[model samples]
Target chain A: MSMVGGRRSLVIPGEIIVEGNFRAGLNTYLENGKIYSTVMGLAEIRGRVVSVIPIKSYYIPKVGDIVIGIVTDNSPTYWQVDINSPYMAILQVSDALPRPIDPAKENIRKYFDVGDVLLAEIALFDKLRSPLLKANGRGQGKLKGGILVEVSPAKVPRLIGKRGSMINMLKKELGCQIIVGQNGRVWINSVNEKLIDLAVKAVKIVDEEAQTRGLTERVKKFILKGKEKIDLESA
Target chain B: MDEEIKLIDENGLRVDGRRFDELRPVRIEVGVLKNADGSALIVQGRTKILAAVYGPREIHPKHLSKPDRAVLRCRYHMAPFSVEDRKSPAPSRRETELSKVIREALEPAILLEKFPRTCIDVFVEVLEADGGTRCAGVTAASVALADAGIPMKDLVVGCAAGKVDGVVVVDLCDIEDKYGEVDVPVAYMPNKGLISLLQMDGILTMEEFEKALNLAIDGCKKIYEVQKAALKRKYDFTEKLKREADKSEE
Candidate 1:
């Protein structure tokens, strides 16, 4: 009848987190009225709900989630993209661009050659089949002329911040176009290289300090102070 | 014609100065490899093993893909200089069989049904060996799997109990294992109280076998504590880092 852990408490696999009246969430499971943690994570308790947030893990692709991938292999019709997950996602030629192309006349490589970066969304996931990605959406295609900064997929939510507050702050203050992938890929495009670097630093700070309290303020100050220093030095 | 080998001395202490019911010092470190999804290094006494877990992802060789569950593949390898005699780089017959057994030992603890048609690969390398390589490897692989954030019912812990001379020791070192009358290695899930891997070599009476099994299980419980402690240490360190970040923000 008593909870075994408090907010921000760390727990390990098989560790009992609650004895009763709690629903397990995320990295936890319930058995015989007892909630148990299933990973090495920090415990979060919200009212009667308990969840464990994993500190380190691979990004598991989910349908409708946006992802950034590196094209690694190609077949006649599809491109194998590495999304920083255990599974390789396939982007079919039909989904690579907005319009269809003649298979016989047009080469698939020209559409999405190997080593290209893609900002795409998971279209369908039939278990046992390679994940199918749709890259035809607006702003979804081969990404170029920007820096790619990688963070932990689990911390991607923090990079986006509450209702996009943190990212919006970064964009409004720094004038950068930012795209965050659920697969832990962040693409930052800005006219100035200094602004892009500042954005990257902000993302890294979020990734490292996501579980900490007051992360938004820390990232904001870090980015703002960094930009001021850069401008001061330039002047 | 032969000199007597004393695995246990007159004071009832092991050659390494441990009691019969005592285990060797075990040190576990998680997240050692950057490229691996999950990785851990375990050093037990003089035995050192590195384990890395990759995937619950796509299965290679398309034919091997299981429609109903994920395939768990474990590779157990000993380095050329792991033992006194330089081992061959090739997988020996013993290594092949140990790999199979080790895989079976860890398979039951994972929730394979959740990741259908994928493959979870566990690679364990013996960097140094004195004794109980299989048990040490299993211990390291379990932590690596957990570190990789693979959901499971529980983490599997392993320990070896052997009858040295006439004493049933909790954990056996090289000298004791060589001269031991019987060696029983066990991998157990403490939460479920299940034995996943149990192997015995040499002779034992019914009573001795039961006692050895109990001892191995008890030893596995001790190992389970260390495993949980190591994981807690990692998470606690992360928590400390978060606290520092929060304080710096204020």
Candidate 2:
């Protein structure tokens, strides 16, 4: 059975086929091997069937997404980064850009020590299942001037919200650059340290209240009140 | 040993402002995993442990035979970055001993006779390790097993009491543990009022040991309450869902 306006179940992992006499609506796959109606809005896929999920807002890193990364390590270039996956990913220098040696002045650990969390993309997979990552993207570099908060990897989706709504709220309210590392590490940066602190607190609050409904409105109100309080105090 | 001390003071108030014999904040969430038969994540102070119960499945490797009782396999693993110093990926000897202790601790309470010829693997992963990791593992594992719906005689609560500079302190934090002379970790089934596991390190007089043991038992009793509440919360959630489904059907 096909759905109409409200929602439809995703039946298969392929493109959404809307043929003659077949109605189009928001389709989703059911576990019991049946396609059914959904209560969500309609989603349209391009030319081919929209088999895979959409990637408009917050980029949820898939198994293999070639993105830019930072050199979190030096000697061996052993880097830890987020590819939006569950695992705490690693990027080795051997696998990264292969240009060599200056022992006197250059220290690998200095390049990426304990606190120097970097940005890298997953490269190759080994038998032992370590993510061989690389840093070759445009916007990838050492995270600067941001407060990092570690959270449960499972909560990443909730923090990102349905369609980047939560993150957008923080961006608008705090006016800071917030980058969520898929490995449960969140980096928040702003010119005003207080705004950065507020953003971090807001993210944490959202994380704590992830299971609760209507969190968006609640958070929005919280940010507005916080902003007003700041304004009043400054005035 | 001589690092400027914080968290514990001359007045004996903990950083979080708990008096001596007080435990750090504990939050237990059970049945948190979709895949594991039973799972629990326990956070005591800053330390966090995720315990997953998988099995009563067929024993692997074939040769190690237990004709009567099911073999219990327990693995205690701390994430590489669980502590302040990044630990190596390999399981250290200390971790191995702790794993054995934990396995033995749970054995008596598990009713292994019921699942003879099978094996149960209890995996405890320390996402963050402060102090009292072994005790945390036991507590978390018991809750996870219960969350998995595994029948147990009673839940086990684990706690550590240590003597610092000759003063008996219950629930030693990281620094107290590092410099303190004595540490006695005990796991007990509060419902049965039986000790499942007991271990001590460093030097303690007989009287001191006994006092520490008693304090550990007290600490366990406190933790047991948390374990029960977590289990009840999870059960109530699932029960509520089932009742709603039943109502819909009706």
TM-score of chain B of each: 0.95, 0.90
lDDT of 2 by residue, A1-235 (tens): 2434433222211222243333333333222332221111123434323222211112224445443333333444466654433223576655444476454566667555655656655566532343566664655646665677865444677778889988887788778888876655687888887677677778877765555557888888888888888788789
Candidate 1 — which residues are off by over 4 angstroms?
A: A1-6, B237-239, B242-250
RMSD of 2: 17.7
Q: How does each model score on TM-score?
A: 0.93, 0.49
Separate clash counts for every candidate: 0, 18
True contacts kept of 2: 0.00
Candidate 2 lDDT at B191 equals 56
Across residues B136-247, which tens digit of lDDT does each residue of candidate 2 receive? 9999998876654344556788999988766788887777788777888899987567898988888888898888888899999999888877765553433555677799
